[model samples]
Target: MPRVQDVPSIPPAGRADDGGALPPVLDVQDLKTFFPTDAGTVRAVNGVSFAVREGETLAIVGESGSGKSVTGLTIMRLLGRAGAQIAGGEIWLTRGDGNRVDLARLADADMERLRGSEIAMIFQDPMSSLNPVFPVGEQIAEPLRLHKGLSRRAARAAAVELLALVGLSDPARQVDAFPHQLSGGMRQRIMIAIALACEPRLLIADEPTTALDVTVQAQIIALLRALQARRRMAMIFVTHDLHLVGDVADRVAVMYASQVVEEGPVADVLATPAHPYTRALLACVPRQQRGEKRRRMTPIPGTMPSALAVPSGCRFHPRCAHAAARCIEAVPALEAIAPDRRARCVRWREIGP
Candidate 1:
């Protein structure tokens, strides 16, 4: 296990196209996470790879059970308690000091030390993530106390500031309020405050606005954008909504049955998808054109395949409308479809726009 300090820095060769000369803050390469169930080993995240540069947001979009959240949790190393394991691949994380470390190989102790200060995660459910009995301020302050070694009083004061930063009204009074006292949106804001308290270099927000109303959801999205802009931190936003992707994410990776079927700039992918799964997902989102009535969403024909028994060849072939005999013969590699885009469909040239 390499110590955080001893990890060597990554060479500044592959700079991001949009983020100037900065290297990716988090580069996940071929990550595979598995869970051993009573029936079989569930490959929750299989061969997933993507990168997020500082101040950039990468959205993992897919339907329920498509491994979007699993990939995020895998990156955060939060699946151990649930009997999941990193089966293979590298999770190269660039640290604040310019050193890069493969988090997959890091010792649990070293990883723990890096969790709050270098990387943080906001779970889907704030109510379940927060300690019910503890005051929201204390919960936010806990990371500051542990990571920064701040005095208790100072940590509390900083927590109040974070609440305000996240746009929570009456931060001073809200700090003393318990989780149960807050509304769903407020609790989500508290969760965001806690995640951002340590000023982590990379933040993984897993469906941050899932439970909020439309207005509050919009508010949360705006708040996240503002916070990320101010802090210049890399973020991975996991969600099933393509609508939210356009607003929050710079790049989008579409996952299906534990694999990334398509990946590219959010605008490019949304406008003209390259993979069948990506197109299917877009079709499910209701849309309206100029001088035209709103089009009804066309639901995908089949459900996501079970991770424990994923289909051979293309995992998405079962649900893909463009799947041909060749698609079922062998698994297609994630081939580059364009300069900055990739798709895992063999017939992408023939079927893609």
Candidate 2:
């Protein structure tokens, strides 16, 4: 495994290296997303930062409304014009062939080209993501035909192949079926097939296995891991399940109130989370082993603060049991607590997972 120090630091925007080559695969520095509403400007993602390396799985875990989906949408440049806005920061993208592009600044036409071809997303609701009028095959084939310039016949055949690759049975028969015809798990498989159709270097899966049976969830997860391994693709797995993150994530970024509160190797963060929020989340996961008869899960106290009225300093401080006076007065920088591990808590060193 490569050490954290070995991963090169991505230079700031407009400050590319003299020999200026390509940008990082996905370099996100201090990204922020705001939504202007009747009441106030909702900061959905505030100064959140991370990177997704080629052929790695970075999992973002947070409670609902913690800006997980917003971050993913921002990276894909899919945020709509009506309410959302990228207030600051840069999203740099590097293609497989070494071409560097700034995703945040790319024109609409260029961004369209990159969406399905260079990058793809697997949305949470397979039922809603698929179009009712279009046959499953056509939905999968659309990207292939659009990006790869494949003939109609070739695209159709490729779609069948993708279906089989994602573990669907009877690819030919399933191809002609509509989204409503397939089971939840099967529809998710189809979504994976479409996302993988273009051989995108980056795949953002937003809670891909949710709303499925346990057996089906396991299968979908296994399929994702296999596809990621076979394609050597960089994947962003967004889910609230720490157990799932333990199984798949190479690295983990814990988000709270539109901010990356902590990030580091999956094992390190899971075993000994430095941030109070991280520790509280870990404690909430149910364990069935031979420990003392467990009380009910120790869910974090208090509900998530509303997006429009996020607390100052550390967003997690209000719910954090270990919060101190400093936590209320000043915000914390994402300083290194360990090699490649960082936390946005002034007293990270004192807390234990």
Candidate 3:
């Protein structure tokens, strides 16, 4: 069996981007994650690839179970060893120096050492993510002590600082309070503080505002955007709503049936979606345009395909409105339909610009 001690550590830190106007901080290529289920193999993430550049926010937009969440976990190497594993491809992450390391190939120990210091993740549910027993301040300080090599006292002080940074009230006293003592919004703020504690280059926010009220949701999104700008960190914002994407994302990747059906600039792609799935999702978003009081939101016709028994040709063919005979006969690879834009459907052009 492969072991942590046997896996080699990546080279010394180098420049985050090799050298370009906006070089990639994370460059994923042909990533495939599979689970060995009793019923059948579950291809949770199949042949997925995307690059997040320095200081850019790339939103992975999709409905539940489209593998958007799994993709983030895979990048962080958070999947447990027993059930699922990365079957193929590379996850190239640029070091502080100009060089890059393939995270997929890194040893478990190497990944652990890098996870908090270079990459951080904020899960969907803060209440569940935080420990009821431990104080939230201690939770935030744990990573600082572990990865940043700070003393317990120093880490605690830093935790208080982080709390203030995230805009928590009375952070000095709040630092000593338990998770159960905090409100839902405050707990989410704690999660953000913990995620940003290490000042990581990449922040993977997995539906951070899903549990908040509509008003609170907007507040959290604005807070995150401000933090991202102040920190100048590259972010992978995972969510199901295009509405949320519009607020924080510079680019967007629409995932369906465990694959990215379309990708491009946020404004461009939303304005003129290339894939049927993208258009369907956009149609579902509540919009107010022109003199119309409100546009009718149309839900996508069918549910996402089962990963265990994905459709043979296009995984989305059964649910795709514009699926042609060719779409059902051959699995279309994600290819560029236009400069800086890509879609998986072979007949994406026919669907419209």
> TM-score for all predictions?
0.94, 0.92, 0.92
Better of 1 and 3 by TM-score: 1
User: How much RMSD separates candidate 3 from the native structure?
Assistant: 3.7
Q: What's the lDDT for candidate 3?
A: 0.86
Descending-lDDT candidate ranking = 1, 3, 2
User: Can you list the residue pairs that collide in candidate 1?
Assistant: none
Candidate 1, 1-353: lDDT as tens digits: 12465544453455443654666899888899989989999988889999898999999999888899989888888887879999998898988877888888777888898897899999778999999999999999999999898999999999999999999889999999999999999999999999999899999999999888999999999999999999999999999898799999999999988899999999999999899888877788767778898788899997778777788899888888888998889989999999999999999998749
lDDT of 3 by residue, 1-353 (tens): 11234433353345334455555889888899998988988888989989998789999999888999999999999999647899998888876654567899987787888787788999879998899999999999999988878999999999999999999989999999999898888899999999999898899999999888989888888899899999889999999888889888999999987888889999989888888888888788768778977778788777777887788888788877877788888789888888788988888766677
Better of 1 and 2 by lDDT: 1
Per-model C-alpha RMSD: 2.5, 5.3, 3.7
Give candidate 2 misplaced runs (Cα > 4 Å).
1-24, 288-292
Q: Which candidate is the best by TM-score?
A: 1
User: lDDT per residue, candidate 2, 150-194, as tens digits?
Assistant: 999999999999999998889999999999988999999999999
